[model samples]
Target: MEFGEILRLSFAAIRGNKLRSLLTLLGIVIGVFSIIGVMTAVQVLQNGIESGLSNLGAHTFQIQKFPVMASQAEWLKARNRKNIDLRQAEYVASRMTHALYVGIESFDNGETVQALSGEKTNPNVTVFGENPEGISTNNWTIAEGRTITAADDRSGNRVVVLGKDVVSKVFPRGGAIGQEVKVDGVRFTVIGIFEPKGAALGGPNNNFVAIPLSTFMAYFGGNRRSLNIMIKAKGPEYYDDAVEEARFLLRTVRKVDPGKEDDFSIFSNDSMIATFNDFTKYVKLGVGFISFISLLAAGVGIMNIMLVSVTERIKEIGVRKAVGARKANILSQFLVEAIVLCQIGGVIGIFVGILAGNLAAMALELPPVFPYDWAALAVLICSIIGVIFGVYPAWKAANLDPIESLRYE
Candidate 1:
């Protein structure tokens, strides 16, 4: 018989036993779904991390008291180290010849801010004390009004820049510029408003108020509080030199011993991205293991169902063999049927998995992604499973003697 005729026969047999075929296909569907769904979700999250979380501009890095990824022991050691201060930041900024910009920043935690107008208030607002260069180093753009200037930091002026969220909340009536707002009881005039930055891995990026470093130190007491130093190189070519210069300056200013490790941590956008990828690698491995187990179970189910199918069609196999059907032909026909069943299941699973994965992405506020490679892999795995499981049953049917098969039924 032609290949087309054999395929038609296989479809006829499946259609004849609709319920049984469906039950067998369910296992394969679930198996494929598990793998594809997990992979899709992982890809989407990874994409978000690479694009959204790595916000540091080109050739830029930050020096802080703590490491971005640290063990408990490292954290404890870092906690005991002296805080990076505004004076040290300024020294490094003034001395580093290869640097294009240096920004000094400190945070005042647990602060409540309210407009003097008394119309609105935020119970918990982050307050940042930063120098004038912070705007460029942090890659923030001013949406309305002017940013903190050299005059503001030098004169210790009580001026502030509002994040989009803070602006919307405290200045609902608009005209936030030149308005006075109380930060933890100290009054500050709004000089600028920042553009919306949305949320990142570290949380809402635009829900804070920025003030001059000098003013923050005056009011919040800079002692014992760690300052973050942001530095940007003139270009990518000078990034290494800039980092080395800043490190040397910081170590010298802090009076670190020659043999001992530096107390500060310096990290760039590339390091942050590498760390994130390393963490997600393990997540992918765990998910892949689970999906593999499911597929293995589905393969077993296919083998069991194919064996039953061979038994049920024993008389039909005998008649075909008696009519000059070769053992190879019989084997191929049964194999094709098994593969077709798995393919059907694979298609359904891919569709469901993509849908479920995108739904999860939506819940997390991540962009939807279609994992085409994973979908193709799912289909390929399904085909492989079908062949591995189908071979045994197909061989058994082909090797059976026509006379015995005919006599049995």
Candidate 2:
């Protein structure tokens, strides 16, 4: 028989039982959707994070009290470690010969900031206490006025640098440079405005205020307050040596035992990306396993549906056999029908999954990601599932006894 004839018969059989075919198709769609949706979302978040991390000035890294991303057990252990204070950070900063600049910073978050003129920001605004050197270390460019000076840090002056979002909210008419804004009810005169940095890791990046580290400790410091030290190397060639010098300086200042591990974490943009990737590995593994099981179950559903289709069409199969239709043609027809159903389901599943994942991207203000590799894999997997599950029913239909089938009630 011609391939066109076989295809026509296959489509006709599927059309004959619309409800059943649709129900069977759903299994495949669900299986594919689960895998594609989760992976696509993961990739989008990963892209956003990488983009954000890249903005951390070249040849720079931060020394913090704990890992940016850590498991519960790791966090618990880190919580017990001694906090790295302003004194300790400064000690490391002073002795690091390879470092070009070292920045001391700490933060308080979720503070409602109010402008003296009556405008205000939401409680989610992040307030950072950073030294003047942080302007370079953190890759912040001044858009207006002047940045924090060494005197600001030493005197604990109530000066603030506003991010673009904060500037827009408080000084909508544009003179933000010297405006007095209340940060969590404390009066701080705006000293500068920072260039806008877009959303990062699917969250707002420009909704922040920077104040001198000394003033920050005066208000927000407690027994648990810790400092993060950002260091920038003079050049790319000096980066590793600078980081090593900083590490040794910290170890010596903190008096860490020679045999013990360092209490703090040192990380750069590359390391941050690596840490995030490690976290996503578990997510991928778990979702991949669930998808595998779901696909197997979906394959079983396909087989069951095909078997029923073969049984219902026994008389028709007999008529075709008696009219000299070959067994190969009968087998091909059933197999093709099953494949067509799976392909349709797979296509629909891919479309829905991509749409669902990109919706999250849109909300995060990040660019959408199309995982072409996964889509191609889904198509291949669907074809394999069709062949694996459709073979038995096709064989059964092809082997029917024409004379007995013809006499069926």
**Candidate of highest lDDT:** 2
TM-scores vs. true structure, each candidate:
0.87, 0.82
Clashes of 1: 0
**Worst lDDT 10-window in candidate 1:** 197-206
After superposition, candidate 2 runs with Cα above 4 Å error? 1-9, 44-59, 71-73, 97-100, 110-112, 122-124, 149-159, 182-188, 201-204, 214-224, 233-241, 311-330, 356-369, 396-409
Count of backbone clashes, every candidate in sequence:
0, 0
Of candidate 2, the 10-residue stretch with the lowest lDDT total is: 217-226
* Tens digit of per-residue lDDT, candidate 1, span 360-400: 78887878899999999999999998899899999999998
After superposing candidate 1, which stretches have Cα over 4 Å from the reference?
Answer: 1-15, 318-329, 351-360, 398-408
Model 2 — TM-score against the truth? 0.82
Tell me model 1's lDDT, rounded to 2 decimals: 0.87
